[model samples]
Target: MRSWLLKSLYVLAALRYPRIRPDLRYFVRDNYFARLNQLRFWRADFLTKTPYKVVEFYGEFDQEIRYAMPFAYWHFLNGTLKQTVASKNTRPFYFFSPDHVEKYEKRVWEAGYGNYSIPNMTHAPTYDFSKWARVPFKSHYQNDVFVYDKPLLVIANKYNIEWDKPPINFLDIPALDRLISGLKSRYQIVYNRPLGGQIVHDNSEIMDLGEHAWLRTTHPEVLLMNDLFDQHAATVQNFNHLQLLVYANCNHFISMHGGTAALASCFGGTNILLSHPGGGFEHEFNEYNNLFPNLSGATILHAKSREEVFTLVEGRF
Candidate 1:
């Protein structure tokens, strides 16, 4: 019935916006079908019974890096604990979408959960457990780390888009160049780009930001310094796991305020979050504190300007 209703809404939207029907179709698929699958699995947890504890994560499939990785890992830690404390005969079973199941199967299994699965309408109920879980930061699954040989500094920047209000939480090309130049002598710097199409706005018009926008739309020369500096377009090349691995091993991380920053937080290193005070999202810092309250060898700083960022990075290194 719900699927029928959503399909009806999609049809209505298609008829109403005939000119951009293709975009509307994608919008419906992402917003409706994806979210509906999450809801179905979440609801199934309540009706099913298992010998072991069950934890359900349902929502926000679109931003896998920001929402899925950190949130799912948190639950995976909790599910492992619940199973261990309950009984050796029973083990926790985690339910996630098949896409996630395929991508993160090894990591989920290593976190100590008994089983992870994709659910359907007829699936039995599993326990609905709630309570945020925290675990030590370590490279649990992928043991092979990318050794930079030299001191490594990972930089994540946002361009051609505005994610925050007022001052805007982005570094201009010149500012970024200065930051990179200042550290080039001391560390090997690598730029990490977000994995997905960015939004480009021209006056009142908006459209998808092309994949090569970073290389073509911007001054490519600014990024292509010498062998000392490198750029990794993770999203354009679909290098999600590789990006995570690099973040896991980097000596330091500097990122704009966004999902990538959140994922970096999980790695537990010297992290500097460049944020705009006008954005009014200061609570994110406190939330991260709670999530990673016991992280050792980790220092997190919030910087708003080039000088502050440089100073923070210098102080850390």
Candidate 2:
């Protein structure tokens, strides 16, 4: 329903802003600063021979639109600003923030980009993080409220079996059971909310959503992005980036659909899906690879045996 409403809003926006109507994905939800980032990355001439001022405004926002930054700094910052007499040959970057935007704001500013605050982030209008925000930061709003004393066993969510197609497996009971059986001895378990583009209906008669089924049946405690869990305060407090950082730093594990493989690959952690048979979907067939070079790594292993799955994670810990 929320997604539908957002889509409707976009349709309405098309009528209101004809220029953005066709490229709503690049415009609509973006704030002025984020919009600028997209412009800069796409146009290189935006910068002069001088160094560019690249202000990075980061916070515990709900989501981070990392891809848009490259272009924004180039075109908007360097192009327009650099053309000005006072601003010529140098770049200035501004980041509006509510939380940790300061850290990023400072880093980017000190490194050459200028930082400026717009309005107080706490007062920013609340909306869905996926559609517009550069990075989701709801969890960052209440950082002190949640704490993790012991090592966390982070289990990210996978919306479905096949993102491009309907799900073939309705219940990944074996995967869940084996995960529990395999790691029960080594770690105190807690399932984390799954992020990334994988979308699954909580109740899908079609595609029989296997990932949702596993969460509903076995690890009823598993966190759903849509639903807040007991650790909702904590999870929200930590935001999703902290989870990634934790996984990157601590003794964490990954058992996800192939969508998460790139992060797992970069972090050097145990990604359970890597052991799947035939390495999941081969990306050579994926059409979007040209626009999104990252999708080329969509291939993952579909587990052939429970033992193979168990062995994959067992060695990682």
Question: Per-model C-alpha lDDT, please?
Answer: 0.44, 0.35
Q: Write the per-residue lDDT of candidate 2 for residues 1-317, one digit (tens) a residue.
A: 63564566556545655643264322342333332334434343334434433333332121112222222323243333222111110111112211112232111112111221111111112222221222212222224433355444555534444434554322255667667656645565555444332221222222333455566676664434334333354633323334433444433545443434333332332344433333332222221222122212222233344566566567655
Best by TM-score: 1
lDDT against true structure, model 2: 0.35
User: What is the C-alpha lDDT profile of model 1 across 86-182, one tens digit per residue?
Assistant: 1111111112212122222111212221122311111111111132222333454224445555766777765534432233555665666667667
**Backbone clash count for every predicted candidate, in the order shown:** 4, 32
lDDT for residue 144 in candidate 1, whole number 0-100: 46
For residue 57, what is the lDDT in candidate 1? 31
Q: How far does residue 293 in candidate 2 sit from its true spot (Å)?
A: 15
Model 2 regions more than 4 Å off: 1-150, 159-164, 168-171, 193-250, 263-269, 275-307
